[model samples]
Structures are given as structure tokens and as C-alpha cells.
Target: MALMDGRDQQHRPVALVTGASRSAGIAASVVLTLAQAGWDVGFTYWTPYDERMPWGADPEAVTQLSSQAVGHGARTAAIEVDLSDPHGAAGIFETVERELGPVSALVLAHCESVNSGLLDTSIESFDRHFAVNTRASWLLIREYAQRFLGAHGTGRIVSLTSDATVGNLPYGASKGALDRITLAAARELAHLGVTANAIDPGPTDTGWMTAEIKDAVLRSTPLGRLGRPQDCANLVAFLCSPGGGWINGQLLHSDGGIS
Candidate 1:
């Protein structure tokens, strides 16, 4: 029961963001950012996945994010659906279009990041990661292109990615897959004027970063402190802008100076 992203003057554009379960997370920031930039936003979230997280779940977070976005003067919609379902993308697009408008931009922000190392990773865990993080994105992107095929000359697709190589096996590996998959998506959508890219937002303090972890990240990052959710949202806003149209099919490291 929450709502909208980009549109022309006659109709505002609508940005659909997935994984907006945390008020303190990037999805929440992206919602506000796009709304400020004049795009109605339609964001999606799942409570079950977030319920098991260290920070626990807040079903109210999505509603709050929606209210905040609307307070900024943009129409908003909050879809509480599980992205892991194969039919999820179809339903999401249908609902967003029905309530918000045509989705001009897609931000695949929903992901399952359990702290499982290689030794501790299970087939079920790995499969779940792939289902939610990779398969869902693939389906959403495909649906996005097909929805506006040959009618529009522009669209934006931004997928969240990570550089985790070892400690976070399943989540990291699935994010890597998402990054590669985006390349193909970009190529396929180039003729239609849509741009697809991925961003690895360094180590953000979304409740997972402890004092020690923050200190460790600070040493590697050029910036003194941990990144904020707004940092990721800012880049995404730019990437979806007219000025960012030239850069496509690439993974830009929005991770400050963390190398």
C-alpha cells in the first residue's frame, strides 16, 4: 500500500528498487535520492529474509522509506514481495506499472548476504544466494527490456555488487555472477538506449560493521570513515542521469579508494 520513479513532464519517471528492507540501507537512500531528483519511486522488500539478519527485520522500514520519499514530493509504492520466486519479477513489474507508472530505472538492491565462508557454505545456502541475488536480477532485467522494447530510447539498470573473494563465499560469488550478467544485459539493451551497470559500494556501515571492522576498512579506504548509504545512492542517481548516458556496460568502483 505504498507507492512511484522517472517520467516526462506529462508523466513522471518511476524508479523501481528492490531489497528495501532496512531503513539504514542503500535502498532507502536510493528511494529518497531518486525522488529528490524528480522520479516517482516503487521499491520492493521481503521481511522473511531480513528477519534472520543480525539487525533483525523491520516490516515498517519499507513503509517509512515510502513515506519519506512521498514527503519529498514524489509518488511512491512499496511492494512487499519475495524476489526469490521465479515469477516475482513479472508480478513486481505488473504492480509497479499499475500503481506507480512505467519503470524507467531499475535498482536491483535486494540481496541475501549470510556470512558463510567456503568451508561453512552449504548447497542450500549457495542456491538461495543465486536464486535471490542472481536469478531474480536476471529475470527483472529481461522483463524490463521486454516491457519497453522498441518503444523507448532510454532506461537505466543498476545492480549492486561486492568484491568479497573468500570469507563471504556464496554472497560474493553470486554478486560476481550478477556483475558479469550485467555486461550481457547492457549489450542486449544497447540498441534500445538502455544502460546497464554495476556498483561495488565498498564497506558500508549497514549494521554489519563493528568498531574493529570499521577501523580495518578505514585503513584500506582513502576516506577516513565508513561509507554511508547515501554514497551509493548518489552514484546511482548520477548513473541514471542524462550526463551518465555515455557510460554503459561497465562496473564502476564507487568504493571510495578501497583497493
Candidate 2:
């Protein structure tokens, strides 16, 4: 079978980053960085309004993310899908393959949370979080392996995570699950030349951090600064490169030495 569109037959790898939308979102940053590194991009996005609807629907964020990719010089496709749905990841990857091409690098950056404590968190929230963070990532890696690894003989997957995993934040468990997923999947894809890894961006300044939280996080970091989406994006670009081919099954913490 021939490779897909966003995929380059010229030997340049194609990248698909999920949940790319905002200027400061890691997914968008990854798209720009990957394009600069010469890889075409595909991404998916969801909006708050879509949360009230049924699964498999497109939202406003998808349009925005797709436009940014094209603006950044990447042959881009932005699909709309509710990532919280069980079938969301698979459907999105299928679209990428059908529309963009076979993806050589996959970035699973979809994350959802309500910021509730254990007592306040409901089963609905927990399930939604896991579906987006852990299960969805697994589905993406599986698709990447089956589709690209067979033909091209090499692939890359980078999952976004947070320090909450080790720090025991409410959603930390989900990040931890992804951390384990990266390692396990890396070993499984080793023979196919597919490498899976993770990035834990601790206390990032993604417009979601309040002034007090940012100050506290910066003070605790050895580098005395919070992480930027660009910092994480730079590493992701390298991991998608030929030089990064050997870096598999590792979780890189881009938190300026903050555990």
C-alpha cells in the first residue's frame, strides 16, 4: 500500500499531534516544531461545547488547530472528535491515514480534567480523564504501529504528561498510566523500529497557571522558572528526528530539574 498524503515519500517523516489548538498548547508547539524539522502534521481538537454532545463529533477547536498547522508550513489536516469517547482515538487515526497519509510520528497530547480533589471527583470525571489521557494514547500508538511501522520500518510516539504523576496530583495517576504505557509500548514496537516515549512538563505556564501558582512553581525549580510549551516542543522535535531514533521507552522530564 502507498503511504498517505502528509507522509513524505521523499524520506521525510510525517507527524500527527492530537489536541493541537492554542498558541501555548504543547500540541500546537509540537506541530510547528515538527514542521520546522521537515515533518508534515495532522491533528485533532475538541471544544467545551462538544462535551455536551454525543461522541465522534467535530468541534470548534478542530478548525483552529488545522489552520495553525497550515499557517506553520505543514501540510495539515485538523479533524474534530470527542477524545473522551472510547472510539475517538481510532477514528481520528483512521482519518489521518485516509486524509493526510500514514503517520511516522504520533503525539498523544489529549488531556482532560475538572481539577477536583479525590472526594469531590466523580466516577464520570475519572473515567473521562482516563479515556483521554491513557486509553486514547494506547489506541493511537497501536494504530501507528500497525499502519506505519510495517511499511516504513520506523516510527515515533511521544505522549504528554505532567509532574502530577509522581507528585500525586488528582490527575497524576493518569499521567503515571501514560508513563507506564510509553515504556511498555516502546518495548513492543522495538522490532518494528517504532520508539515510544513520554514528556512530563512540570508546572508549565500554559495560561492555565495562576500568578501565585506560577510563582510557587518557579521558586521551587532549580532553574527558577516555569516550563514553557516551547521547551517541551523542542524536545519533541528532536525525538521525531533520526538522531532521536535511539531514544525509546524513556520519560524525559522537561521541568527545569523540578521533580
TM-score of 2: 0.86
RMSD vs true structure, all candidates: 2.1, 4.5
Model 2, span 72-147: residue lDDT tens:
5557767767776777666777777776667888888878755666567778778877888888888878777777
Worst ten in a row by lDDT for model 2 = 1-10
lDDT of 1 by residue, 145-197 (tens): 88863344468999989999778999999999999988888898887789899
What lDDT, from 0 to 1, does candidate 2 have? 0.73
Task: Count the clashes in each prediction.
Answer: 18, 4
In order of appearance, the predictions have TM-scores of: 0.95, 0.86
Best by TM-score: 1
Instruction: Tell me the RMSD of model 2 versus the true structure.
Output: 4.5
The lDDT for every candidate, in the order shown, is 0.85, 0.73
Candidate number of the best lDDT: 1
Alpha-carbon runs more than 4 Å astray in model 1? 4-10, 149-153
